[model samples]
Target: MTPSAVANLAGASPLPAFAPRPRSRPNSASPGPFGPAPRRLAVAAPPRAFFSSAPYQPPEPEGYSSVREYGLVPMVVETTSRGERAYDIFSRLLKERIVCIHGPIADETASLVVAQLLFLESENPLKPISLYINSPGGVVTAGLAIYDTMQYIRCPVNTICIGQAASMGSLLLAAGARGERRALPNARVMIHQPSGGAQGQATDIAIQAKEILKLRDRLNKIYAKHTGQNIDKIEQCMERDLFMDPEEAREWGLIDEVIENRPASLMPEGLSAVDPPHHGGGAGANGRGRDRDMEEPSAV
Candidate 1:
């Protein structure tokens, strides 16, 4: 029977048939059937090649190489590698006829002084060279080298003692300036016999002792020549360290004059003036006060 006739007979209306929904195909821009699409993270790839293709190597060391396959290595390495500025400054000072001996007297120091004195003598024999000394003293042989050179050189060397001149240093100062040695009012002076050591067999030690005696006698004669003191008296005084103030040094004929003023030419540029030694104070730069306790009769 027709649904419309049946409905009319039943006095009821037929309901409209429902349509089915269409299924969607999976796509790149669309979500999956399960839900929303999962996110994908980007990753970077490692490089296959380096900028340098050569095998790794270390840089070569510069200047001197202390390493050696065998033999003894030096405990100390002497180098003259100074900055250009220092070289320039020293060069200028050399031209000014002013040289400084501000440290211990030693072979190296004597060499430098000898070189400068020789140069000055060759350049101008009459040119006056001023040597400023402030040392506690050192090797006797080294000081003697400088002393003999000062007398041998034709150039007039004016030694000004700005601080303490001890042991062989005193001899050098007294011998300089051709008996015209000058000392600062606060300077100190000391003289003592040269001390030495011998390490060997019995005969070798005896020989060294004889040599030391001869050296001491020679030094005594030199000191006597510069100062009017009798050789015997000077020898006796040198047996024990003889300490003297500036005034006492002048009276002893170790120095000619005690100057109160420091000449501009004598002072080095860029250096501050040193304060005078205190009368009853602590040690000064030249070790004026400490000599009584600390002074030793070593090589100087």
Candidate 2:
């Protein structure tokens, strides 16, 4: 009825009241005649089937195994390890003044090559830079980008052909410092006219065609200048894909000689022919490189 009574009723919950817990009395009968009952001994619990785990196993040295997990982290670690090892070798190579161009020439490859060449020249203009080539050749402009840099640098670039130097690759071999182009025994070289596949409107195609002709002529001149061949003869030879072995390449001026024994020059002390002082590396130099001689790292 009053305000306090109304507030108390409003605050109360509508749940039923709980019953208080009942109490139990102790046994009235005491330990009479025997004083107390005999007690039983406690028994222990049996052990569970918790078998021990198998012994630790190491990862495979080489590839992988189906029994084990091969996750992204392991794969990434492997790749990074390989890359680091390769880079160590490359740094060793740069220190030794050796470079390589061993893939299809392209803008990316050419850019790296140019940078290496320039850097090498700056490192020591007197020390020669070796440009090893094993490519099938690619973009004419890209190839020229390297060739132009080779000429621009003050250092002499000694180019060595390992597997093959086809088309622009062959031209680069010839473009090396006079008397420095050399190929491994059994290595092959190829030469051909500049090739193009222009696709566009008729007028644009015509203009591209003209430019290709100009490139061809310019390349012919470059070959002539480097190989000491007559422009007419070079042009005639370039009419088709002309592949030549080391000996033939040498005779044709694509290379100066075919190497059999390891080069004695630049061979550091205690650097055996069997295990040459070498490590893998990446690109740099005045971009001093074989035109993208941006070729991947050859096995050291």
lDDT, model 2: 0.70
lDDT of 2 by residue, 1-300 (tens): 999999999999899789989887534454647675555678645322211011113333786432233232111111343473334444556656887686666666788789988998998988788898988787777788899999889998888998988887888899988777888888888888765554546776677778768778888998888878899999899898888999988888788877754464434334533341234432222222111221233433
> Among these predicted structures, which one has the highest TM-score?
2
Q: Which 10-residue window in model 2 sums to the lowest lDDT?
A: 47-56
What TM-score goes with each of the models?
Answer: 0.59, 0.61
| Candidate 1 per-residue lDDT over residues 1-300, each given as its tens digit | 998888787865467657889887656557778777776788644322111111212333565232221244223222334522223333445766777776666666788888988998888998788887887787777788888899999877888888888887788788876555899988899888887765556666677778778888888899998888998889789887889999999989899888765543344334334433234556544443322211111111
Alpha carbon lDDT at 98, candidate 1:
72
Please report, in order, the local distance difference test score of every candidate based on alpha carbons: 0.70, 0.70
